[model samples]
Target: MRLAWKRWIFSLLAACTILSLHAEDEADLEQPDDVPWEEVKSTLPAYPEAGEWLPFFVTSATTNTFYIDAKSLEGTKDGVMHYTLKVVSENGAVNVTREGMRCSTREQKLYAIGDDRSKTWREPRNNQWVFFKKWAINRQLNVLYDDFFCPGRIIVYNVNDAIRALRSGVPVSGKSSRD
Candidate 1:
């Protein structure tokens, strides 16, 4: 009986150790490959607040710049954070307007550095703007350096994902189909 108990304890300890190591490996895989982790951390801008406008441009195409006015941050509820945003083009034209864009905390942490604030903005594509939201600025840096864009053109990464979700017909909080 004593020996059986000892074997059980040893097995439990070994399993726990293996699980811990696996988690550590998964975390390391999440880091971006193009930029050094430290550089990515140093380059991020401060988190935006209501009424602040942030100018962002894709590095590969410098002239294609846009602005996002931080309209509001409706606090997190049920593990998801809600945001309101206004995306404008360089010529002072409003491209896309979003109300209560939903971002889950899990997605926020994956691409963000520091406190992993959810970052969502619009990017231009095919002569129109598309919504793209990543967790952090570091993710943006990685995308700017590695992703493909047409000459003198800027586009968002996987805009279709947002479109697909929208087409699914799920309504955002505080808004209804009747509205």
Candidate 2:
């Protein structure tokens, strides 16, 4: 009898919890959708100057930084935002520049490391595992930043995981963070 009563109580509690969560989701959905662009910009940190690197996202392989030399913002009639960011990197003696997008959708365009003619990336030592790591990082960032109501200025890689990964070292080029 006690076990049956306890089970009934547990089921009731679970149902109540689920209903509460559903109510909260409905409340959020019903809220006004007019997010002021100025307010959003105000929430973000100050833009990094030409020479400074801003923390875009990080991975086990590289602490990816955005040297946004220039940025242009535009808003579509449907309210989608577009950002054209000019990124410059100086790895060794080679100076490479590419135009990347930080936009409202997953249609991101990432350029090759070298110039248009060369189309090659001379990756540094201890950094061959960057592209895959970066792809995953950007994928998650898209899910977060693409949301119009997402209240986040930046996405950060877990510090503990980063330290562990660094200590363990790279495990071949295409290996993911989970591996």
Candidate 3:
């Protein structure tokens, strides 16, 4: 009789715990979805110097070569990773921009553009966070997010980890290329 009573009590406790968790989940689901998320203020970094550019492979299909500024990589407290990107096309046209990526939402924002002649940064007209597209022509940001900075949908721990991941061509957290 004692063993049976103990078993019954244990089963009851387990069921009660499961129901409580379920109730909490239901409450969470009932909350409004329009709650605004707060983002940390961003201070734009200086334009990347010529020596700070580190080439990263995105895909072989495109003739444009992509590079990230080693000195501009930063992991912010709000989980946003900021960096400067430089793209050189086969035709010799070069484009440079400062950008930020949020691993939590898989979104990217263009902060500023670099003027090669003045070696200065200018704020982009549309400096809004937008979801990454699936098209092949714009795969540079996606590659950076998937391979180096935000593998497994989690941001790197710090700037050093991000630089390490870039240099090694893999994620620092041990997640595989596409995990």
Candidate 4:
């Protein structure tokens, strides 16, 4: 009798927890269809002027996901203005925290890296695995200075993993994530 009663209680508790989580998810998804663009325009930090090229962006790739999943940067707007960000998982498995940089030749088009071409980037600096993207730094500055021979950004994923994910196509890309 005790085992049966305990099982019933546990099941009931589990169901309640799941319902609560679902409710929270629904609440998070309340924004309009254009919310992504709105957030990008309003929340994105302004670039500090660089000399020749315009500094476009210097942030973690987690920016998009964090904006979508959490609706805010770590529950605060200030955290959004960062070159580094973290991802927290419910199970804590594939959590990510990395910084990225992207620079642009035009001030109005600084945010075109990854999603666009023509942006100037620095050669990937592989200093014992802690690489840096000069494009990102350029975006946050008032100059268009970079070492072209080393402008390959050290992407967040390894070559194999990147190939696999890229093969997964638009799903891995945020272009389809909003939907």
Candidate 5:
């Protein structure tokens, strides 16, 4: 009796498999490899150095240039750090906020950079269009600390993996690491 039952189950499973194969939607299948991909272009920075984490940035940076100012960075969770960038413009008067984007690690450690607003009417005084990255809210990055080290781009991976790379030396670029 047990053997017969086993045989019945196997036959039923085989039938189900055959039926499902025929029932699959065309959309579920992959496109034919012979078909060519559509030609497309963009004007953004591409960060190939950005490790496993799905690279995200303002201006669609990842869509173009991969160059990052390692010198303009601060502490990395392990070897990676989150980041955001803001551009300000000013002539001799007020401060204006320009393009800005916030990029966080998979674990959500924040990162951001602030620059001049480009509008003299809104520009901040006593500072020359200062640009710097803020680690924590109250904690600001030091531009000339000399002790600060910049982490690399190949740090944390995805949301599934939350480990980071640590930096102990100056980054490749000469931009301010902290502001």
Candidate 6:
């Protein structure tokens, strides 16, 4: 009878230790590293031509139509995805931006802004990576993060994968690829 009790206790302790170790591993995955993040240098993309812009759906409340330049989609070696985005307002004004998104950290950084008149790109004065905000009025980054580019917190495997997700209107992580 004493041997049976010892075995049961041993089994319980072993299970507890395994579970504890698994929990620690999960915590480690969730924690950010103490090392400062260094962003890879990005080059500004050319101004998106009207024909190259592919429209994407954002929130219904927004009057602006969002688009991604089909030709500008790029996946970098450092896990940063670069693309040029275009925003067309209902009033006929257009805004273009070249940006990079880091799927692992849910952060985005603006690389440059496009001038439609001169067809030139200019760097933003405050270019930096910022986390996506849940309550932002314009949830373009969130839509891209959750529905297309960074689904499941993993970036699309390549530029073609990103383009596929954009064209199919389905997330990269989705079980079914519409296209």
Top-scoring candidate (TM-score):
6
Ranking 2 against 3 by TM-score, winner: 3
In model 2, where do residues sit more than 4 Å from their true spots?
A: 1-55, 69-71, 86-105, 109-179
Identify the runs in model 1 with alpha carbons over 4 angstroms from their true place.
Answer: 1-50, 62-64, 99-179
Model 1 error, position 147 (Å): 16
Candidate 6 global Cα RMSD: 15.8
Residues 1-179, candidate 5: write the lDDT tens digits: 99779768876775575455443242432223555423122112222132232211222111221122332232333333333222222233311121111122112222122233431222233422123332222122222111122222233224112221113223223333431
The sequence of per-residue lDDT tens digits that candidate 4 reaches over residues 1-179 is 99779768876775565456422132332223443422223323222122122112222222222211111111122111112222233354322222222211111122212111232332223312122222332222211112110012112222233223323432223232123
Query: What's the best-to-worst order under TM-score?
Result: 6, 3, 2, 1, 5, 4
**Model 4: how large is the Cα RMSD against the reference?**
20.6
Worst 10 residues of 3 by lDDT: 22-31
Q: What's the TM-score of every candidate structure?
A: 0.26, 0.27, 0.74, 0.17, 0.18, 0.74
* Per-residue lDDT of model 6, residues 1-179, tens digit only: 99779768876775565456422132322316677656677667557766476677776556789999889888776667888898999898989899988877777889999898998899799787776543344578878777677777677757787777778776667643212
lDDT of 3 by residue, 1-179 (tens): 99779768876775565455422122322213465666788787766665477787776555688888888888876678888899999998989998888877777899999998898988799998887643323778778887778776677857787787778877666664434
Residue pairs in steric clash, candidate 2? Answer: none
Q: What is the overall TM-score of model 4 with all chains considered together?
A: 0.17
Q: Any idea what lDDT model 2 has?
A: 0.31
By TM-score, how accurate is candidate 5?
0.18
Error of 2 at 46 (Å): 22
> For model 4, what is the alpha-carbon lDDT of residue 61?
24
Residue 112, model 5: lDDT of: 20
Alpha-carbon shift of residue 132 in model 3 (angstroms): 1.0
